[model samples]
Target chain A: MGETFKANVIDHFNFWVAVVLMMIGLYAMITKNNLIKKLIGMSIFQTAIILFYVSAGVKDGATIPILEHHAAETEQVEAGEHVEGHPVANHEAHAINPDDYSNPLPHVLMLTAIVVGVATLGVALAVTQVIYKNYGTLEEDEILAKIKAAENDG
Target chain B: MIWQFDIIILIFLVITAVISLRVKDLLAASMVFGTYSFLICLLWAGMGAVDVAFTEATVGAGISAVILIATVYNTRRDSSD
Candidate 1:
């Protein structure tokens, strides 16, 4: 029981931490009305997602698949195939298996996600600025009151 | 091992829900919500859902938060209290 503690504890600890962070971020977004604080919440929420992705993508001791020309080549020296005149050694060509490489799918997906995130953030910020200009105050209640008054007057 | 991870995630989830309910400041509440999204994303990562994680990070943390905040900006600064 004692020996299995590390495996039982460490892995669970990381998972729990991520879950907690997510919960906190989500709750804040739903109930908070302050604009800046909302953005802060947004940032934290986004960061938590990033952390999850990284945690899931990491493979133990996996190397990124960068293709090296000679790396795939295998040297097969025949018993008496050596010739003094030839500068290059003759090795039979061997087929390469694609399974030995790290996965590139996640990286590609992440790149797109990152781009989309930034674009969304920019648009949201612009909208917020506009709202601030029109409402004078950024509070939800005040905006509601103003709208309510306008409705009542008309 | 798998069960442990699930349990951990579940516990955080509960805390987040409770905090969101108890907090007074709407701004603070939103911030906490965003944090919740982030935590879920990390959980996806741990589960070997790299693609899902990427999507969640952007949609959950990035876009969703922005939407809420932008909406917030349209309103009053002070809470109802």
Candidate 2:
């Protein structure tokens, strides 16, 4: 029983860390008052999701997705045994197995996500600067208060 | 499982997160946030996601931090909400 618990911990530890990061980011986004801190929280939240994806793509003992030239040669040698010494016959026949390397799809998608995140952070911070320029404050409530005062005056 | 290293990184992440959020100074918080992003990059790289780590490091740690510090530069140093 104890062994199974330990195994579960080992296997899913990365997931737990991602979850914790997500929660921390969420908490900050909800509770923090400063605009920059909220942006930081949003960035943290994004990174946690990226971490979850990258960790999910990990496989034990898996190499990078790029295929080596020798892989086909080695595979042909292993497959040639059953063909009665016909060593080079199926050189171009067998396809590379998918299990030998980590998945690249998630990595590709996260590349886009990270770019979007940076862009969004930049835009959001620019907006924060604008808010401060107009209202002389970055706090959400203070901005609301200024808006209300302008409304009342106008 | 290399669980020890992962746990240690996670601990640092949590510590930085709490400190970054709770700190009073916006500049200090932004710096701590950059540290958090960097730690996340390390965690991703250690998990064999080199591409993701690269993106995180460049965007999260580098570009995002610069943009944030610039925003802080244009705004008040203290939050009053």
Candidate 3:
């Protein structure tokens, strides 16, 4: 049992770390009273997820997704020798195996996610600023108490 | 991906995450959180996602940290809980 656990830990180390980080972020978001701390937690959670996706796309012994061309091939292309419409170059491109490159889909998806996360963080911080302006405190409980007091007075 | 490098970074990542949450000072927490983001960016770069790492460094570490520090400066810096 111990050996199996060790093997699993070794094989899926990245996934395990991502899960741990995610839990830490969730804990902060749930337990913290400070609004900015919660925002930081949210950012941590988002980054953990991005890490998970990017790691999932990793290929063993594979290069990045960009295709490399030999100088001879480039010179041939530039000389218009391989300009026989779509067939020749396409055939040459197809000759390269897909498995030689890491999967780019997850990376592309996470790029959008990272942008969205940043935008969300910015918006949340702005809202936090507004909250502070109105209540004069950044603590959640204080804001809640003030709101309740206002409600009781009204 | 070198396992040794990955393990070291992952360990630091978790440590930073915990410290950022546990720190009482808001500015310190924001700085630790920025460190956490930068560590994750390093992890992504090690995994061969250069573009993702670049974006994380700029947006997550740079802009997010700046915004967070600005917010912390504008508001109360101490946490009650």
Candidate 4:
């Protein structure tokens, strides 16, 4: 009990919260019957993936990965001042390096994921429209009933 | 304040999930789930993952919700008894 908890050094609150949400989303997906609810569950599930990717890409005390801020602020910066691509020192005392920049790769990949998600959502919504049209009802059970009735009649 | 905000956001996530599930109405569930996604995106931003936050805001909360609402509109509105 006297030992300093080494793992305590890591701030794990964010990770835990993300995980709980993820589990909730997963459970919702698995148990929900309504197709719309299932889609919502899927959204939550995708949210967990988004959180995981972002969490994985995080660095301590980092900012947005976008360089859009650099272009507008540089005019106010003096010569040899902190600027984009400027040489800076590392966190270590007297160690030479560049200012730690946020990781941009995850942002790029997430952008792709966002676009894909939207495209897929559009296609899915279109399909749902069709599913609604053919059956004259959107209830999954009703659709199944109709299919079964049709089969029996035939 | 930051820690408190994060904590509240997290608690809201769980509560909303449970409430969404408990509600018999699927539209309400989808709306609540969308709110949940929005909160999670903010939580991501708090973690300095701005890109993920943006994606979540756009895709998770936007496209997904739109699709779900479309589905709900096309399908039945209430839970089956």
Which candidate comes out best when scored by lDDT? 3
**Reference-based lDDT, each prediction:** 0.59, 0.81, 0.88, 0.67
lDDT of 4 by residue, A53-126 (tens): 66677675556655555544543453344456675543244332223445667667776776776676677667
The positional error of residue B72 in candidate 1, measured at the CA in angstroms, is 14
Return whichever of 1 and 3 wins on TM-score: 3
Write the number of the candidate with greater TM-score, choosing between 2 and 3: 3
TM-score for every candidate vs. truth? 0.53, 0.86, 0.89, 0.73
CAPRI tier of model 4: medium
Model 2 regions more than 4 Å off = A72-97
How big is the positional error of residue B57 in model 3, measured in Å on the Cα after superposition?
0.7
- Show the lowest summed lDDT stretch of 10 residues, model 1 chain A: A72-81
Candidates by DockQ, descending order:
3, 2, 4, 1
lDDT of 3 by residue, B1-81 (tens): 888899999999999998989889998988998898899889888888889989999998999999999998888788875
Q: Per-residue lDDT for B1-81 in model 2, tens only?
A: 255777888789888988888888888888998898898888777766778788888888888777778887778777653
* lDDT: the better of candidates 1 and 3: 3
Docking class of 3: high
Steric overlap count per candidate: 42, 0, 0, 0
Interface root-mean-square deviation for each candidate? 7.6, 1.9, 0.9, 3.1
Question: What are the candidates' individual DockQ scores?
Answer: 0.12, 0.68, 0.84, 0.54
> Which residue segments of model 3 deviate by more than 4 Å?
A1-3, A71-94
User: Against the correct fold, how does model 3 do in TM-score?
Assistant: 0.89
How accurately is candidate 2 docked according to DockQ?
A: 0.68
